[model samples]
Target: MRRVESLDVLRGVAILGTFGTNVWIFSSPGGLAAVLGGGGVVESGLRALSNGKFLALLSILFGVGLAIQHSSALRRGARWPGWYLWRSALLLVEGVLHFVLVFEFDVLMFYAVVAVQCAFIVGRSTRVIRGWMIAAGVLHVAVVGLLTAALYGKDVVGDDAADTSRWLDQVAFRLDNALALRAEAVFVLPLGMVLFLAGARLLRAGALEQSVRGDAIRRRLMTWGLGVGVPLNALTAFAGTDWALVDRYLCAPLVAFGLLGAITTLVHRTAEGPLRRGITAVGRSALSCYIAQNVLASVLCYQWGLGVTGGPLWTVTCFLIVSALVTAGAWLWLRRFPRGPVETVWDVLYRAPQRISSRRTRCPQGRSA
Candidate 1:
């Protein structure tokens, strides 16, 4: 399938934005606890601005990709979602390795698992998909409501600190307590399905592609999205306040959608230039870049390496610098190669079986027999 620059740009923004939230976690000795504890105005502000927003963007993009793949398969006269099952399976394997070896809090495994379920609805009627989305949204809200009530006045922080002295032990511990690590996924997967369906809906409606209706849709999304999203996100920044739950469940998703609208609008308006090209490149290789960020974080922040721990400013600085380097690397790599290393590997793995099957079909009759 041909690449959509807009999706790529939005993905680039998501990748960088994810780093904004993750940097604090990566750099803190207190791990997740330090990030959630609210260091100061800067930290709180960053958390309020980012946190769930980028993740939402990434999830939405995942849905968009699935929709695009399904459409492409139909166009090629292949079975619906023709290589997607293999792709999702490979992604799950990649996600598992990443979770066990790189970051315990990785979302890829959950995404892959959810994606398998998402595939079932690919060519379903719009009404059916919409119904599913609504159901998922309601469930998400209910779950969040229950969680809010359960932890209403409590201070929720990091689950447990990793034993940084022994890296292998830390991995083993996380592996043993895998369910705990996937606790967030229980709530997240349904919400992601909603976004995935929403993406497919948009594609079906021709909202993402360039057209008159697309322009009008983008405008509405920008206006309504920001109008509702900004204030709610602002409310989420107050630490130790009663509003944290509301901010997380309600405001965060609003802010995320709003950001997506704004990003889409900007990507549409901006002229093609070096800046656009670089960001698009980053988005194109998002998986590679994301994995690289975690790898770099492990080396820089973990006790086995630099063991650097600091406040939000330090983390933010690190994030910006690393992002710049990664973007530059992607741009340079793209100049010489058609795809990122990870993307190439993904394609090769998924396509290998098809290639073998085709070769077998083409073999001489005697040899085939």
Candidate 2:
């Protein structure tokens, strides 16, 4: 009902949903390679449907959140521009730390950098913003599709063949790729800003606030997201296994957005129940839970905790179970604390430091000044 609660719920879902896709990396035989369907058809299919679709959904929500933050700032008469820049910078730092120290795949820092690019446009006219969103989404898909087609034609078949040089090349290739794409800028940051703009536009148009539109739109989004996500995902599974036509990066984001909209609608429309409560609780501590899940997952799969590296599909499933439990545990812990540990630090970063005067005021000394 409340804004923060609504956002927290969505953020929580996005965080967990992201893990839903990432867990495959933790529990598969070839690690991430297996989850990418390098192992076999069934595992690959499962991973595509689970991970691809879920991550897309998470990305779209990231956009929605950007809008929420901007809108909230404007509503309170706060000078949002400067504050957002600072916040984005803070996130960038956090993201970099996450990448270098904890995980090489960290995306936040990139997103933080990307967020700066669109700082000026978020508050612009909805039509203009919408145009940019459409253009970016379409261009991105087209480019990816073209690239996939070219690779397919070049016989660049997706293979798990172990090549010593290939492994070495991957690092260099990813670095160059990251730079050319402005990896975070093109892939996530822009997409998120666009999505946030759309969400804000929708909010302004009363899409979420209006009962009539809410019901109609929610139902439609849910239907379409599931309808398309299921079949296309099936196709993706088959393509990855048989043909390699399905580009997860390209198709997944679209499917995920539809699914996210659908789910958001369902969450709001459905009576508050266990599922809602659980998700909301998790959402409340989303930041902490998000980082925690990654850490927990890493330990489970790394040469650490269970040393369950290169495990089977079943093992990955177990990792999911454990991760979910950890999320629930974190949610429970937050019941008393109100915010996750990292979230608290984020708050400190975003909020002004408190000042306690050390100088004591001597009683006016019977002061008749």
Listing every candidate in turn, what is its Cα RMSD in Å to the true structure after a full C-alpha superposition? 2.0, 5.8
Residues 36-96, candidate 2: write the lDDT tens digits.
Answer: 4455666665566555555555555555566677778888886757678878888888876
What TM-score fits each model? 0.94, 0.80
lDDT of each: 0.79, 0.60
Model 1 whole-model lDDT (C-alpha atoms) = 0.79
Model 2 scores worst on lDDT over the 10 consecutive residues at: 353-362
- What's the residue-level lDDT of 117 in candidate 2? 57
> Backbone clash tally for model 1?
0
